[model samples]
Target: MHHHDNPPQSVPSSPAYIRATWGGTGSVEEASAAFGFSRAKGYDLVRRGEFPCRVLRIGRSTRVVTASLLRVLDSGEPEYSGTRDAHTAPA
Candidate 1:
């Protein structure tokens, strides 16, 4: 028999969960990293409403909901279209 220290599990990261806890608002870095996007591209998306638009702005920070990102990923909604070659942003 084989012994395992940890069992396989499925779970999103803690920050991802927390950011969506209050509906929507993810740290720029977290959101960027979550979707394998660069900081600059992430900010641009935030501003362009390309991804899930930030529900609120707090001081100098912004947050994006994980749901918005998921929606774009999960569905083929025309509004959430992306031009892969046109932008160096990550998938």
Candidate 2:
């Protein structure tokens, strides 16, 4: 079994715009960046069942649905502050 004791792994931060173009399976950082949040925030959201479940895993990594993230962003209509600005908050 996978060790639940170990903290989750992280993905490299990719450009949000490019991530938006990816269409599916985004790294956690890519999704988080689209939401204008830190990777930690993304994990927290996942813990809270706010983000899409990981569609795939590579080694110690997780990949989320880019389409889901984009749909989320589109539905939320965030201002794209790239920070925790309530005005820029995702729907």
lDDT, candidates in the order shown = 0.55, 0.57
C-alpha positional error of residue 21 in candidate 2 after TM-score superposition, expressed in Å: 4.5
- Listing every candidate in turn, what is its Cα RMSD in Å to the true structure after a full C-alpha superposition? 7.7, 14.2
Error of 1 at 21 (Å): 9.2
Candidate 1 residue runs with Cα over 4 Å from true position: 8-24, 52-55, 70-91
TM-scores, all models, native as reference: 0.48, 0.50
Error of 1 at 46 (Å): 1.4
Candidate 1, lDDT over the whole model: 0.55
What local lDDT does model 2 show for residue 45? 65
What's the CA error at residue 6 for candidate 1, in Å? 1.0
Off by over 4 Å in 2: 1-16, 19-23, 52-60, 77-91
Point to the candidate with the largest lDDT. Answer: 2
For residues 3-89, could you state the per-residue lDDT of candidate 2 as single tens digits?
699754433343456453575677777677766788899776654445543334467876776655555565664322224334444
The alpha-carbon lDDT assigned to residue 51 of candidate 2 equals 56
Q: Estimate the lDDT of model 2.
A: 0.57
